[model samples]
Target: MAQGNERKSKLLGSGDIVVSFEFFPPKTEKMEETLWSSISRLAPLRPEFVSVTYGAGGSTRERTHATVTRLLRETDLKPAAHLTCVDASKEEVDAVARAYWDAGVRHIVALRGDPAQGAGTKYEPHPGGYTNAADLVAGLKKIANFEISVAGYPETHPESPSVEADIENLKAKVDAGADRIITQFGFDNAHFLRYLERARAAGIWVPISPGIVPIHNFKQVSGFAKRAGATVPSWLARRFEGLEDDPATTHLVAAAAATEQVMDLVDEGIKKFHFYTLNRADLVYAICHLLGLRSARTDASANAA
Candidate 1:
């Protein structure tokens, strides 16, 4: 076990923490406006890279492509496009990977997405599709030398029969050429630490970036957690207690909660994070600022002068 003072010193010391944000492609014009507004607000922060999420079973395939291509053309930010092997055949999936490569997107978040039937349902791979994430990773590698990031589950994946099995699956993805692991959002810092230890013990050496979702709406996030198999601890529930009637207070509480969570991870020696931004930037921006991230626009303006 690490000494308490050692952990504290590590947290207090300077480290270059890399951050990335995830946004889903919008489904409608109003939502598209909101999504771009949020993207513009966060683009100035100079995140390591921003990712656009693909919907289940390639539901948002076209929209996700449009969003990613726009980011490529208009922004100074690096974009990571998400690709999943849920409903598409191997040929179709490979075509998409080739398209992204030709479009100059060099990073991908590879996932074995949830069933099109919805959460908690059994996943049936398409007869001609890549069977799982590892297979998809290998397929993408064949198409291009893309940097691939695969999902990790601190709380075992719902379909995983055991934690040991889940680790093995993660190892398979790594072996298949994944570049990094971006975990599913987790509330408890201890869970992430333990998961990291387990991954190391299993001989997986890729950088595992902890996913952080600042709780803008407790009820909504709780539902998401339930579906994703992340545990919302009692302590976390208590923190949001009685704030339902006040949006202002909820936002403040959410920022503080998320900031503290990240700080604790920093104390434990983590230096990278992936934020699930949910198409809203205020809370994520505030938390990033608290973590000492400054807008690159400031430097750009000074340089221009």
Candidate 2:
């Protein structure tokens, strides 16, 4: 391994780190207001793109579409609308894809979403829908030249039989025309690096960006990690052990923890990241600034790409 000092010197190498954010479709008017407020603050960062997530079983189809199209119409940010095969037929999914294409939205984060029954349940694709993410990718390609992003699981998807199988699944998606793979949120940098090494060995070279979730609330986030099949190391838990009632301390710790995580990955020569914003902007915005990104409009001519 390279020496820590040696790695630190390259933290901002060439000064370009492609970053993206993920947001869920808001479920209520107040939540919608908060989502737009967060967007207004983060839009200044000029991420490579911001994505709107579809709910499980295509539940947020209309909200996701409206939010995505609104971003396209009202802001300068590129919006990637998520498409999934969960409860829709192939034709219905294709129709949605066509509508996005017509709206001038070109990026899609295609997923084989979770079963509507929720986590730990088996995912059964709609009998007439695309069979999986790979199938969805292939179908989207036929509809239009959309930039497709598919999911990768650093820890191996819970339902997958093995790590090798997960990589093979990801490779299948890439081979089906996915432009990139954005991992499910992960906390351990080693897991991501190992996944990257194996993926490269298998000839899957499309940019595989690690999904980074800033731990604004360790309790809530750890719960998410557990459900998503990610490990929350004891050390991480210890850091937040006694901070549950301390919001100020938690905020500081959260920012520092996420910044350190990104810096570690940057030292490993990783240049791309996708943040699970959870519709909160302050922590994420801070992390981006720490990553050497300034507001693009603030310094467009010299901003990090």
Candidate 3:
């Protein structure tokens, strides 16, 4: 719709908005350095909290734990650890949740992780384990008063047989005590708006935060989006066309596209956003800058470090 620059100044001039970011655990030492660099850069922005993703079947369990623990001790930002019920038994998952509590983490992004084989593969819950995200939410609640956020698929989850089924699944999660739902990253504003309408119609009132992925690496992001069942607008694909070799142009278009997307959502009365920050801080940092978010050092209590 409207470009970020074309939006009214007042719309772009709000006080620091409530924002959250998602990060994946680093797989290597070098990547670890980059991850922390991103954390340090974005930390000054003062997100509501930053979440570290859990890998499929708890593949990254140890790495995720290490990353989150470091965030607790190294930075001033609050950390939300992602816990998934994939291959683990109910007791195992509960123990992990207890470990998080012991580590001082109170917020959890509870998920029914991807199939161990991978996305698009069949998911079979471990015997005596959570059958799905709703089950996981209920179990986590028993461990502690976790501020749980669950996943929502704007476009039906790829594995879901129908959109109605997907919505029903999300409704169940909310009923199980989910505090909020963060959608998979989507490019089409209408898709998200419609999803919100449907969620409200279903009587699910939790904050369904739209996930924004500033598409810096277009091809890679497009592939991931497809797997996650997020639609890529044709207009968006064209924006990134012919820029495969030009990283600079890709970054520019990505920032503009994401800023415009969030502005449109804001115009539609959405006040909060969750970003999948692929661990490089600049693009997400720039998008937040355009959204009127300033460094916490100058204004808020985020300078706890």
Pick by lDDT: which candidate is best?
1
Query: Which residues of candidate 3, in runs, are more than 4 Å off?
Result: 1-10, 14-16, 300-305
lDDT of 2 by residue, 1-305 (tens): 45756865245633577799999999999999989999998888878899999998888999999999999899999999999999899999999999999999999999998898897688887989999999999999999999999999999998899988999999999999999999988888999999999999999999999999989899899999989999998888899989989988998898988988988888777889999999999999988888887775768666555
- lDDT by residue for model 3 (1-305), tens: 44556644336653636899999999999999999999988998889899999998899999999999999998888999999999999999999999999999999999998988886578998988999999999999988999999999888888889989989999999999999999998998888888999999999999999999989899999999888888787888999999999999999999999988887787777878999999989999998888888886756454553
Error of 1 at 303 (Å): 6.9
**C-alpha local distance difference test of each model:** 0.91, 0.91, 0.89
Tens digit of per-residue lDDT, candidate 1, span 158-239? 8999999999999999999999999999999888999999999999999999999999999999999998899999999998
Q: What is the lDDT of candidate 1?
A: 0.91
How many residue pairs clash per model? 0, 0, 0
Point out where model 2 deviates above 4 Å: 1-5, 8-15, 300-305
Q: For model 2, how many clashes?
A: 0
**Ranking, TM-score, top scorer first:** 2, 1, 3
* 10 residues in a row with least lDDT, candidate 1: 7-16
The Cα error of candidate 3 at residue 291, in Å, is: 0.4
Residue 235 of model 2 has an lDDT of: 88
